[model samples]
Target: MKNTSQSETISIIGAGLVGSLLAVLLAKRGYQVEVYERRPDMRKNTISAGRSINLALANRGIYPLQQAGLMEKVTPILTAMKGRMVHDLEGKQNFQSYGQKVEEVIYSVSRGQLNKICMDAAEETGLVNIHFNQKCESVNFIDKTMTLTDELSNESRQVTFEHIIGTDGSTSAVRDAIHQVNSSQHDIIPLGHSYKELRIPPGKNGEFLIDKNALHIWPRGGYMLIALPNEDASFTVTLFMPNQGEISFENFDTPEKVKDFFKRYFSNVVPLIPDLSQDFFNNPTGKLATIKCSPWHYQDKALILGDAAHAVVPFHGQGMNCGFEDALNLVETIDKYPNDWQTIFSEVEKNRKINGDAIADMAIENYITMRDSVRDEKFLLRNALAFELENRFPDYFCPRYSMVMFHRLPYAEAKSRGSIQEEILMQLTDSARALDDINYSIAEKLIKQKLSRVQLNPN
Candidate 1:
């Protein structure tokens, strides 16, 4: 057996955000790190399909970047978003705070740029090696080897390493190899919804036409549209709609039809998107899915992280955040159980799977909330009451959204707590609505009792 003190070679598949970050962290700790990526260097690329350059980086992702010492390097490139600006069909807007104040801003960053930063940081480490355009063809856990084929040359090569990490993403090749060897059970459930990206370029003289400090949302009962700021003073808009069977763009292909649909449904956003009809015709449709699996690691020889292990919908904006957290958690585990590869891998699998499942479920539920429930009169009333309650009892009656997005609570715990909070708020709202019909004193007592049971002290 090799001595525990000796340096070990670690191979990481996929040079995406998580893989590159993990490579840098491992290399800094004196391990030999090799990263294999199937795509060409993004820095030199002119065009790439199916890649959305912009994403929202909330507190969940920011904390990990700060710990990795890359937050400062990337912060200057981000645009701060303080809240959501909701647009009504009549060209009116309403502001909803995401946090306590204006200074608490989530960042809007370019995903490609962030990936480049991580890749460059990993390369700067003398112990790290990167092979772009090298695709992993197969992996033999019994032999501790991976077969790679050069995409350009069509030549195959073999590499051996002590440990392997997979961050290859939702359609991960490394994940498939691991499943093949371990006979793991996995499922990918596709939501019936599909999305398409549109753009609202800066107005004349390179000025933004809308507020850059807020994420813009236009919810229309059965579907929703959202826009986030870009560094170029533009906005990247996305429209989430039902797939083939439900509402679609087939009948609204012509410019006249598109304009009429926008006029009736999204009058405010229609004017902002100048090339609306062209964008609708040119943009490719994207599918949404949730990936679920158990036992993320296999016998210390191979492991998976990020979207490869669990891919959630983006409604909660936690996909990248959770992936970044996965890297931090794995590194922390490695630090605690140094040189004990098997135990460390086993523990990671157990802990991450539990949290991943929790977040996936939350993300799915958030989709429903965003698409249909956002405009519900009853739900809005409940939200207003909850916020009012928070003002009255700041410590005890925080809203569920505030806790889940603003606090560092565990994903599973947040979901459970949020469910409880919702029940109490619903009862309170119902009682308030029927105040004139029922006995006022009795209703007040019942509301207080429910609040007390949930630890909410509404003074």
Candidate 2:
């Protein structure tokens, strides 16, 4: 099935979501592909319990799945999360819609299920071969070779390739090799916050304890706890806080302190989890970070995609979506320049690098919005006003969140326009509590003057 006239084949590292998806995408293009995964076959083994077992899939990710002809396979495993259901300290709940329309909602998906489906699809093509428990040891772009150590046999094998793509996640061995060659190429910046996972099982009748259609959050100033529903009527709960602070993970060392901490802030959640203290102490605490690297491709010999190139925090729910977009972008770019590897790599890297950085920065900003601003009165007012402005100036105005989640607008463009939108909102909300008190004439005039317009979206 190899389309190229040359003898060289494409090799991929990491069989996680991005790796499997990339392998399928490349195989579909008639390139013989082989993948190496560090972990055991996830389909046959139970996934390790850790933070963020599920992922939020938005339009950016869906576009790629649709491209791979996987939406039908993936749709059944997904549960729609229309918006953020914010819970107050007293257990009061409020729903905030994520998008303007019904069809604009994001989805909650299990990581293990999605990875298995992708790998299955790749292998079903018969153009891809995946070797499990083969840990990537090193990648030599100069020699066009990659050495993978067999976990079972403790043997190393060097595989040669005409081209290589590293879709390995954060702590990527492929990326580490690139760093060794070029020390100043990348930096992994920690966000100083960590997260721990807690589970909320379903009721006796298999009913969801909370509204299953929404992503739930308990936003405290500087810290928060979030939950997303799973198919089994259960929820995967996560507690995010500073690594070292007045009321951080450090302070929740003892069982008594963990109990009291949940009682103080997540009082309503304490009763939902029978083994709160046990889960809190037993589960691992995971760190959040952004991996910013340059020159995604090492000449034409090797390239890095997904988390290997840019790893953003999960605050905006775009981490997986962005990585999926990377896979789609590279495949399409390669399609355009099939015979020219350098051009394909350069074009993809040039186009995706800014968007990658843009999403990373936006994810950090959204963490602040999620933890503190979601519950603020002014923040709510501005959020409502942003939608109002979008209603009036539909072409010119779209909330940054909507742009990032619901629309295909480039992330860099969204971030740039969002800064301008923020200034306008600040001026319009100056000393005003609600939209009724504002001057519509002045608002319309200022919007027209400062913001350009196009044909409105009928939807």
Off by over 4 Å in 2: 1-8, 49-51, 453-459
Residues 1-459 of candidate 2: C-alpha lDDT, one tens digit per residue: 225423447889988889999988888878789898888888888867223789899988988898888989999999999999999999999999987888979999998889899999999989899999999999887877888899989999997878888888887887777667764468789999999999999998999999999999999988999999999999999999999978898877999999988899999999899889889988999999999998687667777889889999989998789889899988888767776888888898898999999999999999999988999888888888899988888878888888888877778888888888888888898888988877777778877787765322211
Model 2: which ten-residue window has the lowest total lDDT? 450-459
Who wins the TM-score comparison? 2
Candidate with top lDDT is 2
lDDT of 1 by residue, 1-459 (tens): 112332788899999888988877676666788899998888788545235668888777777787678887889889988878888778688887776655456788888888889888888877788899999988888888899999999999988878999998999887888888776889999987878888999989898889998888888867888899999999999988877643564445577876787778888787789899888888887889999986688887888999999999888888888888888777778877887889888888887787788889999888777767766777767777666666655545667666556655567666776776687676666756532333435434544555443332111
TM-score of each: 0.90, 0.96
Clashing pairs in 2: none
Q: In order, what is each prediction's RMSD in angstroms?
A: 4.3, 2.3
Q: How many backbone clashes does candidate 1 have?
A: 0
